[model samples]
Target chain A: MDLGALFGNFNNFLDFTVGGLVIGAIYALVALGYTMVYGVLQLINFAHSEVFMYGTFAVAWTFVLLHGTGDASWSLGRAVPILLVALVAAMLMSAAIALLVERFAYRPLINKNAPKLIALISAIGASFALAEAMGLRDRFAKWFGLDDNLANYVAPNKARDVYSNPVSIQPHGLFHIGGYSVTDVDLVVVVAALVMMFALDIFVRRTKFGRGIRAVAQDPEAAALMGVNSTRVVQVTFLVGGLMAGAAATLYMMKIGSTRQNAGFLLGVKAFTAAVMGGIGNLRGALLGGLLLGVMENWGSAVFGSEWKDVVAFVLLVLILLVRPSGLLGEALGKARA
Target chain B: MLLEVDGLCVNYGHIEAIRDISFGVEEGTVTSLIGANGAGKSTTLKTISGLRKVRAGTITFDGKDITHARPFERVLMGISQSPEGRGCFPGMTVLENLDMGAFVRKDRKSAAYRSDLDRVFDLFPRLKERERQAAGSMSGGEQQMLAIGRALMAKPRLLLLDEPSMGLAPKLIQQIFTIVTEINQQGTTVLLVEQNAAQALKRSDNAHILETGEIVRSGTGHELAGDDSVKAAYLGGDL
Candidate 1:
């Protein structure tokens, strides 16, 4: 409604745009998991949110384990190595959780040819189970007599308390674009996300393993006849998705500075929306959708106030769906073109 | 025999789709199964390729009992199928589809693999022209070619083709059957399932006629093609 107020301050607009992009990068990474899984199995792994959550915990614990806590000052060179370690730790944890979810929650149902609705219920159950486990981490640690320091770091309280980043890497302005300054955080988030995405794109297009994924996505029976182990492909898909989500989790921690037991829930929903917006089963679409959604949400907040940001994002999704039901890039993942 | 199915019974849930059908594909020969839509021809091939579970059967490939082998294991054991409905990966390019067929092979980048690819391209020059094109975007006939060519990429000793001519033009169907004959002559055993009985029987070394879920007749290709009842039921009477 306040169009003039929204567009009047060009610098503010630019700042919001950059902010949106930083968040969008994380969303894109998480959304890739959703899209890739949907492409192959046609099942939305609702537990994927918990996978991202575990990654956040992994990052936080890694910093704690390295004794980097409480606003520790470090040079850029040292900070980079610590961040890399956290990223790897997060990725491994998330991937492990994802595989476990697939093994226990989805695979049995798939093997049994259970109803799609049943699989969805199983995913929701897994999501709740994982979230609750994280929420009750302190109780479990106490009961098990976990190492005092490690337990304190992993589960500070029994409730859903925020876990602040232990490593404090100061943000410095990298450059100015259109009178809006870009920070190191934004640069890292955007660049890292893009690099991972492009790498995934290349893997899907060029590698034999990736070809097996596409084949299974298109026609599992045909793929099996051709000697593609559909089970392995499905497992690898989960692992790849989990790894990307983990990377996104690390970037999210870097930008937001903290995480909670339920942190992944809202962001997971947003990322899933991004996936659908780009086209639910498409990889490139997830990227496009995430960035666009982020920009739109920020611009909407400028116009309608911050409280209306979520409304704006959802509204935009509705409008986009009305115009292009398949999504911006279209649902071509399992049908045609990687 | 390159492949053997004895007393094979397959069921979809409780209802039996294929019932105690026994057949064999001799090495370096083309065997055809001609049947109506629900005559269990596809089910038979699927079971042989390990895509369908056999309720009661013994499948032996090159003297190895493969009754419990997984689909990929079957493929690794030199059995490949261009399944019913031309099950080409629509998302993949023609070349990618071929690469997927060779998924179980260790020498995918070797000269042998390259020569196999060349052999496929030689068989269907259209595929070579559209190697980078998505399989879904091609014509039905072209997809059929890609499916068969993809199966050939596996370098299988026994090729199982189900309904390769199912939705093709008559001319294209003839071309596909010709290629099947050529593939057979190249020393790969073929077990082809087709609705085009006349062409199938003409090219095949042996033939079987399936009705409902059982094989009601079986003989050499020429003998079945000349049989009066076979002509009336499947070959449009005059033939």
Candidate 2:
């Protein structure tokens, strides 16, 4: 009945597919962090998106400090060095933030054996606290002593301005391969995500510390009996997981070229969905799930328009759960089947 | 003494599980706690292994006070426990479970525990056959063997076992008891909790009888097993 509609703009399908793959890679990266922490702790780390958001804000703020907060202070030529600094700063910020969440919020609840609801409340509280601490633009600026400086940076008028440039945010400049054009930023995001994912896989599989992690994930009580320092193991898990979220945040900022105050919220939701799609405790599953979800959302958007992208993930998530509650790979929270 | 528990008490919220329980395990000896259900036998082992807190008492292992230690810290202090109900990681492979037994050994790469792993495999040859199989997927007796082997991997100075004979066939129970003796002879001190009174008493060097959160009798295993009241109440008849 709709043969013309089906055949129309077939090339658009290819473009959306490639674009979806890139987004999927980012989701996979973020999802792996979620999966890893969930694998060991059995807590959702509800503030994890805050961890990612902090990474983004830290990188952006650090760049401002390094390049001076306003127009004509820096050039795109300095991208390489600024990129490194942002990554390192984001990582440090995320690790510190995650550790603080663990120390102030989760650890106490765990000690008290507080019901699951309490932990969830604590997570939500922590998320709100962290988000508001930075989102109340004037208050954050005052506390951090960057009020006037940031205001000027984001002012409506400036030459070669990053903050005040435009209301619409879109990636530009593309390198063509055959008939397809791939932007440098998109390539960087995709490649960086894949590279980090691969490295993380190797670290988990090849290192002695990785074995210790798996051991704890399998049975923390038993692992403790073997002289494995359970506390240290948990801290390290948070650190590594935080680091991944940090890297993903940086890539997101680079690809999107702008980050809203609550940017990590939607990204986090999608990534968490990806994690569940793949199986919450399975590492490779996170990666596969992220890609599948990204592709599904892209195709959905092509058919139904951009507003439906988020809905696509939700639909897939519900369908997957109904079909296989344990997820695509069948892992439960924190207990690896090994 | 390899290990000692003096006046150990434990409470499960409002209910008192154990009160003023005392026992000692000599080095290279099998010390057993035998009792009926709800008699605090497992509770006593849990107190020693640091899984349950001691409300008012002391646990000393090789001259170190461990009453206030954390559970994992107790493992580092050379106390390993194979908990009641076979607390094996069901999702993990048999070999992975064994590797976890050696979790506290930082230098496992160069120790006899490495070879001891092989010995465990030899003792439970069925496990070796299913080394790569998921433990939760295994039979009940096999999971029990995996639990014991995993505990042994800690190379524990004092091993606390809570009901090793639970949920097993009589033949498997005998095999587990024999393994307990073999482990004791291999130089690890053992504190065993069991409901298999006759078999436990026959194999243990020393035994304690618990009834309703209190220790009512203590002696060499033979002495307790030979007691007329013990025979009547626990052994099913005069022996």
- On DockQ, the candidate that comes out on top is 1
Model 2 lDDT per residue over B1-239, tens place: 88888988899998999988887889888888989999988778777777677789898988999898988788888889888878777767888778878877777787587688898987799999999998888998899999999898888888888888889998888898889988888888888888888988998899989999998999999999999999999999754
lDDT of 1 at A318: 97
Highest TM-score scorer: 1
TM-score of chain B of 1: 0.97
Q: What is the DockQ of candidate 1?
A: 0.81
DockQ of 2: 0.60
Instruction: Tell me the tens digit of each residue's lDDT in model 1 across A1-338.
Output: 78765578888878889889989889999999999999999989999999999999888788787765666755345678778999999999999999999999999999889998999999999999999888888777777777365554755564478887776666778799988899887898999999999999999877878888888888889989988888899999999999999999999877776788899899999999999999998999999999999889988998898899999999999999999999999885657465
Docking class of 1: high
Scored against the true structure, residue A28 in model 1 reaches a CA lDDT of: 94
lDDT per residue (tens digit) for residues B130-225 in model 1? 999988889988988898999999889999898998899988888899899999888889999999999999999999999999999999999999
